[model samples]
Target chain A: MVTYIWVFFVIVGSFFTIFTGNVEALNNEILKGGADGLKLLSEMLPLLVLWTGIMQVAEDSKILELFSNLVRPFLCKLFPSLPKNHPALGYIASNICANALGLGSAATPFGLKAMECLQEDNPCKDTATEAMITFLVLNTGGVTIVPTTVIALRLMHGSANPSEIIITSILATLCSNVSGLIYDYFKRRKKHG
Target chain B: MANFLVPIFVLGIILYAFKQKVNIYESFLVGAKDGLVTTFKIAPAVIAMVFATNIFLNSHFLDFVFSYFTPFLEAVGIPNSILPMAMVRPISGTASLAIMSNIFELYGPDSFVGRLASNLQGCTDTTIYVLALYFSSIKVTKTKHALSAGLFADFVGIVAAFIITFLFFG
Candidate 1:
C-alpha cells in the first residue's frame, strides 16, 4: 500500500527533473557515475574484507559475548524482552558496534542475523513485533562515531581535513538516536494502549 | 617512510601474536566469499541507481533545481557549493562522496560549507540503497510507508547536519 506511494514519489521526482531538462544530461552523468561507482567499489573491497575478517575473529573468540556483557545494562533498558544470553542480543550488539564505527557494510550481516534471531522468538506469524520495531528504530538512527564512509568519500574528493567532520557527525547522530528512541517509545505506547 | 613502516610492523606482530590454532585463513576466506555474494546480489540495483544519479546531475537539471533551492539552503546555512552533494546524497552515497571531494578541493576542508557538506555525507545513508537491499532481502513486496518514513528520516538528517554545524561551527 505505502510502497506504491513511494514508487510514485520516486517516479514523479525523476520525471520532474527530466522535464526540467536534466534528462539531456543523462549520458555524461551515466558515464561519470559509473566511473565513480566502480572506483568506490574497488576501494571498499579490501576494507570490507579486513573488517569482515575481524568480525569473524571476534565471533570465534567470543569477544562479541564480552562486548555484549559490557553493553547489556544499556541494551536491557532499550530492549527489555531481549534475554541477556540470546543470540539476537549478541548480533544486535555487534551490529550496533559496527554501525557506531560507521562501518555499515560490516553491520548488514549482523543486522540480518539479529532480525532472524528475533523472528525465531516472534509469536506473531506475520507482522513485526515490538522488539523488531524497536530494533528498526535503533538501526535507523544508529549513532555513528567515525563516519568512515563519509571520511573515505571526503578523502577521495581531496579534502584537506577529512576527519574534521567527526565531531559534528557524533553530535548529530547522538541527537537523532535520542529523538528516534523517544519517538519509538511514544509510538509503542500508543500501539499497546 | 618510518611513520608508515612502523605501524605496519606493529600491526603484523599483533596479528602474529593473536593467531590461534583454528584455521583462521579458511574462516576468513569463507567470510570474504559471503561478502562478495552480498555485493553481487546488490550489484544490479547499485549500478542502475548510480547511472541514473550520474545522468541526473550531468543533465543540468540539478543545477536548475539548485538555483531554486539556493535561498532555502542558505537559510539553513548550506552554501550553494554544497547543494549538489546534498541533493545527490539521498539517491547515491558514492556519488555524493565524489561531490564532497570536489567541494573539499575547491573550498579547502576548513571552509564552512565544505565542512557542512562533509558532515552531511557522514550523517545520512543512501536512502534508496537501504530500501532496495534490506526490504528486498526480507522479501518485502510493499514499501510505501517505509519509503516515506525513510525519506523523511533522511530529510531530517540533512537539515540536522546543516543546523548542527551552523550552531556549533558557524
Candidate 2:
C-alpha cells in the first residue's frame, strides 16, 4: 500500500511532466527534495528531543505510570488488544494529549515510542499490530482544535476573524476522527469473526 | 495561552519527576539519545516521501486535473482556488500550507476561500507522511490497513471541511 502511493506519485508525476514539457521542474524538485526533507527533520528535531527527554523523566519517575493509569480505562476501550499495563499505553496517551493540544511535533516522539513499545510485543515483527493501526488512525484522524499555525497564518494575512473557522474545523475533525474510528472498529471486528 | 502550555507542561513534568526522586538529567539524556536514534531511523522514509511528493507537486498534476474541475466546482459555489490545498493536504503538510499561504495572498485570508483553507488545514493531517514515518521508524513494512484507514479519514475530513466551511462561512 505504501509502495503503491509512492509509485503513483513518481510514475504519474513523471508521466504528466514528460507530456507537459516541465521536466526541468520535476528534475529540480527531485534534486532538492532530499534537502527539503532534511530541513523539515531539523525543524522538528528540537521538539522531539526536548519532549522525549522531558517525557523520559516522567517515565522513570513513575509519573508516566500514574498518567497512563489515569487514562488507562479510556485507552483500553480504544486499544482492546493491548494489555492494560503495557508501557505503550503510556506513550499512546501522551501522544494523544500532545496531538489534542495541536503540538504535532511534540506528538511524534511519543507516537514513535509507542510504536517501538508495540513492536516489542508484535508477533510478526514485520506487520503492524491491531493496536498500532488504531493508534495511527487516532493520530492521523485526531482532533486539532486549536490549529495554532493555521490561525497564526490567518492572522499574519491580516484576517479580521482569524479564529472564526475554529468551530468549523473542530466539527470537521470530529467527523473525520469518528468515521476513522468506526472504520477501524469494523475492520477489527471482521478480522475476529 | 498556547505559548504558556509548552513551558508549563515541561516545567510541570520536571517538577513532578523531581518530587518522585527521578534523576531528571540522566533520564532526559537517555531519552534524548534515543530521540537521536529515532530521528536517523526515520530519515530515509521522510526523504523518500518528500522526494515523491515534491516531484508530484512540481509536475503540476493535481493542478492540471483540478483545472478541469474548476468551472464545475465554481458553478456549485465551491472555490476552485482551494482545490490544490485539499488534494495535497493528505500528501504533504508543507505543500498544503504553502498552498494555503498562496490562497491568503491571492484571495485574502478573510475571504471565503481563506476561511475554507483554514478549516481544511485543521481538518485532517498528512496521512501518507505520518504513516510512512511511523511505520518505517519501527521497520514495519507490512502496514496492513493503516494507510487505507488513514486515507479514508482524510477523505472524510476533506468532505466534512467543505461542508462545514460552506455552511458556516460561505
Residue pairs in candidate 1 whose N, alpha carbon or C atoms collide under 3 angstroms: A2-B144, A3-B143, A3-B144, A25-B59, A29-B54, A157-B101
Q: Any runs in candidate 1 off by more than 4 Å, and if so which?
A: A1-10, A13-54, A119-133, A149-164, B1-26, B29-33, B36-63, B71-78, B142-153
Candidate RMSDs in order: 5.0, 1.3
* lDDT, candidate 1, at A47: 57
Q: To one decimal, what is the Cα RMSD in angstroms of model 1 from the true structure? A: 5.0
Positional deviation of residue A145's Cα in model 2 after best superposition, in angstroms: 1.9
DockQ of 2: 0.78
- Summarize candidate 1's per-residue lDDT along B73-165 as a digit string, tens digits: 788766686777766776666668777777777876677877787677777666666555554444444332344444555666777888888
- Clashing residue pairs in candidate 2, if any? none
Residue range A42-121, candidate 1, lDDT tens digits: 66566556655555555565656777888888888998777768777877888787687776766776676576677688
Tens-digit lDDT string for candidate 2 (A1-193): 6788899999999889989998787778778889988988898787788778888898898888998999999999999998899999999999888887788888899999999999999999989999999999999986797888998999999999888888899999999998999999999999999
True contacts kept of each: 0.24, 0.76
The residue-by-residue lDDT of candidate 2 on B1-170, one tens digit each, is 88898889888889998888888899999989888888888888888888888788888889888999988998987677688888899888888999999999999998888888898899988888889889889888898889889889989999999888778877
TM-score of each: 0.73, 0.97
